[model samples]
Target: MLYSEKVMEHFTNPRNVGEIPDADGVGEVGNAKCGDIMKMYLKIDNGIVTDCKFKTFGCGAAIATSSAATEMIKGQPIETVMKLTNKAVIDSLDGLPAQKLHCSVLAEQAVKAALSDYYTKNGIDPAPILGEIGECAHCAQ
Candidate 1:
């Protein structure tokens, strides 16, 4: 498969490829069967995402997507980060092939899942499930 130079770069030298020991919140996503899985950690302070990190086991696309997502959310408000989408992640990386699109989606989902955990830890509920809100069943899963 052809991979973009940017994806190759990040995949070879992924940043934020670890976990926070005392994370404010943690989000874990993906299945082993899909040949990809991601676990994200975040430190939120005063409604802002002070730091973000992740551990991903997948293809180059998955690693690049996770790294990009972490970089995107750092120092941004949690609410703002929660608005992130797969399109934004892909756009940040220039683009990814159609087959690898779900990698970006996984990254986006991991970030939001982490944020959800953060909110729960702070005794607040994150927004309702995105897929459950009239979204297509295919995308929901």
Candidate 2:
């Protein structure tokens, strides 16, 4: 497979690859078909995402997608981050192989899952914010 230059860059040097000791919210998602697991950590302060991190155990596309997703949401308001989509992530990486499109879906789900967790932690129902995780049966989210 021919990978985009941007994909290679992010995969080789992933950003925000770590953990947040006092994370406000955390999400873990796995691709049932491939067993590609992704864990996302978020630190929200005053309705803004102060920081974001992730750990993905999968292919180069997975790592690159997660890295781009985190970079996209960091320092942005929670509302904006909520609007982040798989297409956006894919575009940010200059595109992924057709088979690896699911990686972008995982990245988007992982972030939403984390935001849902954040809402739950703050005593707010995630349904309004995230429309409930696992709503999509195909991706199990």
TM per candidate: 0.89, 0.92
Whose lDDT is greatest here? 2
* Residue 21 in candidate 2, Cα distance off native in Å: 1.1
lDDT of 1 by residue, 1-141 (tens): 777887888888888888899999898777777778889999988988998889998888999999989988999986688888889988888899888988898898888778778777878766663232122123446
Candidate 2: segments with Cα more than 4 A from true spot:
31-33, 135-141
Clashing residue pairs found in predicted model 1: none
- After TM-score superposition, the amount by which residue 14's alpha carbon in candidate 2 deviates from its true location, in angstroms, is 0.4
Local accuracy of candidate 2 as per-residue lDDT tens digits, 40-92:
99999998999999999988988999999999999999889999999999999
Number of clashes recorded per candidate = 0, 2
Give the lowest summed-lDDT range of ten residues in model 2: 132-141
